[model samples]
Target: MNNISWRGIRAFLYVAEHGGFTAAAEVSGFSKANLSQLVTELEAALSVQLLYRTTRQLRLTEIGQGYYERCKIAMQQLDSAAEWASQSTDELRGEIRMNAVGGPVGEEVLAPLIIEFQRQHPGIRVDLDFSSIHVDLIASHYDLVMRMGELPDSTLIARRLHSVTTRYVASPEFVAENHEIAGPDDLKSLPLIRGSVDTWTLSKGKTRKTVHVAEGIKVTSGRVMRQAALAGLGVTRLADVYVQADLQQGRLTEVLPAWSEETQLTLVCPPLRHQLHRVRVLMEWLKAHFAERYQQALAEGPGQHFKSNLGAS
Candidate 1:
């Protein structure tokens, strides 16, 4: 019956099998009154008396004995199913769909992390999508997504992985041929590779400048933009993480060191997905990986310009 509860069934079975309410209460840690009431509720719901109770003894009726046997088998199966589900949660097994910004950061950084994660958790399969355009995580059925800049969707749960200090960079050859870029205004004089945004914003101390850079080649892909810069195409703005080696190895030159911008890399997921074991594990693993990396960098020296904001959500 609709009003019958599994708890009440369990209670009735305990009293029936143990042969007395007092014995069932002692074995199950349920008080005698509570056990009696539960069995009574079960009987009322079924419209059948299940127990013949007296001061000295409690016994199941003929119909009650038959019902008890059926309930016992069903309860055992239900218990096994519940245990299987609980054990499955302990096992890392599922596919996680993710969307990420396509660039060196995804290729050189995130790709390796995913690979290592797969190696550690061989059961978990990851479906990673790399793109320059922003896609809705919930609508796209993505289990997780990596985003740059501030997230506008307040409905999603997000954690700060790190912030990348951006730089205006050009290939060493391009820098040599072009006029000197002493300030933001000087950037307008040279050829510029436009990225996602048409305008570039830079800040120095308290002064902020927004310049509509002369577009030489416009592309949305950061990987392509980096390639263009590497091939001596033109000046472009890029995250330092993506081009740190290029600057250090003399392949690319930072155009304006004084003026700078930074972008936050956030790990985002739907609130419900964030509660999942696999998704939550991957998220925490990434956060820990970055936190350890940047902390180690900080330990190395003062010149390293990496900041981890793992504390912020």
Candidate 2:
């Protein structure tokens, strides 16, 4: 019809849904004056009243209410049809939604692979969500999450993509200045950069031990903790894969020689229509990148090192 337009229809839907021009204008990225005029023109074209406008408020008339309900369904169908078309290809093409905590995984692991992925399949779009806190994928409408810690209870599928390996870490220079810690107990009375928890559970082979560490300085982010450890602030437990390069190069020393070290980095995906190609492509890309980066970190430090710290603890 003459009144039909993607922008106008979309804007009309937004205003009708929110019951106001200002909010709809915000959603449409249009000035309120412009939106008002557009709606006025739309009603004239349709020869019907869409909204009952007053000085204090606006309410949808019969036509506006009917338009809104149908528009929502139409928009959903439009999005699904677009998704279906995008996923028809075996190649990665479509938007891939992701969320991850800050680390080598986000900066180092996923970042590099995305360039290659876009090059191979130009139609693909990646929206990365990076934050320190865990995200609720379904509630937040995130399609996938690359998580480093325990997965929360949900219907989303989870995949183990990287080993959760942690190790003892301190710079060689720090050790020289602070006096070398011979074992876990030697950390007692040291200026410890404590984590959120007191017990540092370390494992190598069949042995697993949780060392009670007192907090001398406390903040999140292993990268910060590693820097603090290097500055001779105190001992901190770090993911072995994260600090492996330093261990091999004499940059970071493995404080305890015998401790079990293994944890998990998981790939999480929402259950709805998840067999899509973009999800499959990103998952494989992550698995390969993490494997490569993990090996490189293990090779960097002494018996172990940051950057080159390799293998399980």
Q: Which one wins on TM-score?
A: 2
- Per-model lDDT: 0.79, 0.70
State TM-scores per candidate. 0.62, 0.65
- Please list all clashing residue pairs in model 1, or write none if there are none: none
Cα-based lDDT at residue 5, candidate 1: 89
Query: Where is model 2 poorest over a 10-residue stretch in terms of lDDT?
Result: 300-309
- Give a tens-digit lDDT track for model 1, residues 1-313: 7899888998998899899888999999889999989999999999998889888877889999899888876765565445445646778987888998755556556766888899999999999989666777654557799998989999999989988788889998898898888999888777788876888878988899888977589997766787899999899887776566677778789989988687899999876677668888999999989655544442422223222322342
User: Stretches of candidate 2 above 4 Å error?
Assistant: 1-21, 28-82, 85-87, 173-186, 195-215, 297-313
| Least accurate 10 contiguous residues by lDDT in model 1 | 301-310
Candidate 1: give its CA RMSD in angstroms. 17.5
